[model samples]
Target: MPKKWFQNWFNSPYYHILYQQRNNAEAEFFIDNLCEYLKPSAEANLLDIACGRGRHSIYLNKKGYDITGIDLSIASIQYAKQFENSHLHFYVHDMRYLFYVNYFDIALNLFTSFGYFDTDYEHVKALKNFQKALKPDGLLVLDYFNSNKVLNMLCPQMIKTVSGVDFNIHKKIENDKIIKTIEFEDQNKPYIFKEEVKAFSMGDFKLFFEQSGFEISHCFGNYNLEEFDPANSDRLIFICKKAL
Candidate 1:
């Protein structure tokens, strides 16, 4: 059987090249804002799920928190491991599997990382795993795109040039999922990859959270931590706690 779209694309070197413009400044800004809002304890244990290259984990560890970064991409994990210390670690992990049980003080699934699976069952399973990874009353910070706004302002096609490579991109909504197709050539070879994410709304997440034993304590619209506006916000940021 062939590999899953994420398993193939995310593990490819081209994936890093295509998204190389995702700067550390943006990540730091968001994480700083988040820490300001959350005000977690200095000894807090954080689980950064889908932590690409340990950017957030490194920053959090620098801020006096114990952090573990996990991602399915082996290359990304290897790169992240170079930064590990006593309080910071990186591991290759799948979100759908349980990594720890009631261990972390905080769990984060950031950067629209929660909606790639083919079935709702798989998505819920991942959420359950996240729930299991946290302590009683632990916080889960989930950041996802505002699907409604994305669809309303959908751009059908575009071209992005990075590292002297031109990536042709197409996007569409089908079967309640947003599909992004990327095509590019490198070293005289062409490649195509697809990313399919469920267009989950607030209502959808409420159900997912309920099933996973979490309750949303706050919902922000963006990195600034403003109130959520379904039709206007660029991001859907949820601060949840394990349900009693």
Candidate 2:
């Protein structure tokens, strides 16, 4: 769905038809690496901002960390609550303005979790919120889609089927932004969805993070922990530390 679809579209015909079950593979991939790098004590406090489905929090809790996940999607939070553990909890909360400040040993923003806001200011607010929520010398890990790579890889059209429903998808990019339309059909009855995503270069994020009081410590193109190659990498994993 388009930018507006994120407004309340999960209940719309679009999400119901296409939002398939996602495994913990993506979350586990990051958490395993994060644990090895940070070497957080068993008592370290973690906050998973925008934790849809609580995948990361669940995995971390199993690894003996104190975890809390917050997301605005009730549907996603509900699914997350099912796997709650003694040291893990999930709540429905917005990330644009977090409710806590200077409380977490670590904060995670993973799974291409950046850039859904209508404006760059909102996204900046998100980064500032992360800074405010982090303790002194706290670590924050950000995993986001590489804007350049995605835009360059943009395909004009795609055809596929899920649960017997056929889908025809098209994409258009102009002026550093992407616009997409999806048409879902079953028995020839068509259902349409549109999505708009802002494309920001890697430098944009680097400058933004610097202004938000964060210093880049580690940056990777993908979960494999390989060196960052902006043009070819799909995911950008950033490990930034609070400057203060």
Measured by TM-score, the strongest candidate is 1
Query: Model 1 over residues 1-244: C-alpha lDDT tens digits?
Result: 9888998888888888998887888888999999999899988899999998888899889888999999999999999999999999999999999999999999999999879999999999999999999999799999999998999999999999998999999999999999999998888999999999999999999999999999999999988889999999999999999887
- Local error of candidate 2 at residue 30 (angstroms): 2.5
State the local distance difference test value for candidate 2: 0.80
lDDT of each: 0.93, 0.80
Consecutive 10-residue window with the lowest summed lDDT within model 1: 19-28
Q: lDDT at 54 for candidate 1?
A: 84
Each candidate's number of clashing pairs is 0, 3
lDDT of 1: 0.93
Clashing pairs in 1: none
**CA lDDT of 44 in candidate 1?**
88
Compute each candidate's TM-score over C-alphas.
0.98, 0.89
Clashing pairs in 2: 1-194, 2-194, 2-195
Alpha-carbon error at 154 in model 2, in Å? 1.1
| 1-244: candidate 2 lDDT, tens digit per residue | 4445554554354554565645677668877987887899777899998887777888898888899998877787887899887788898877888668899989998876667767778888889899999999798898888887887788999886767777788999865668777887767777777766678677888888987889999998887777789889878889999988
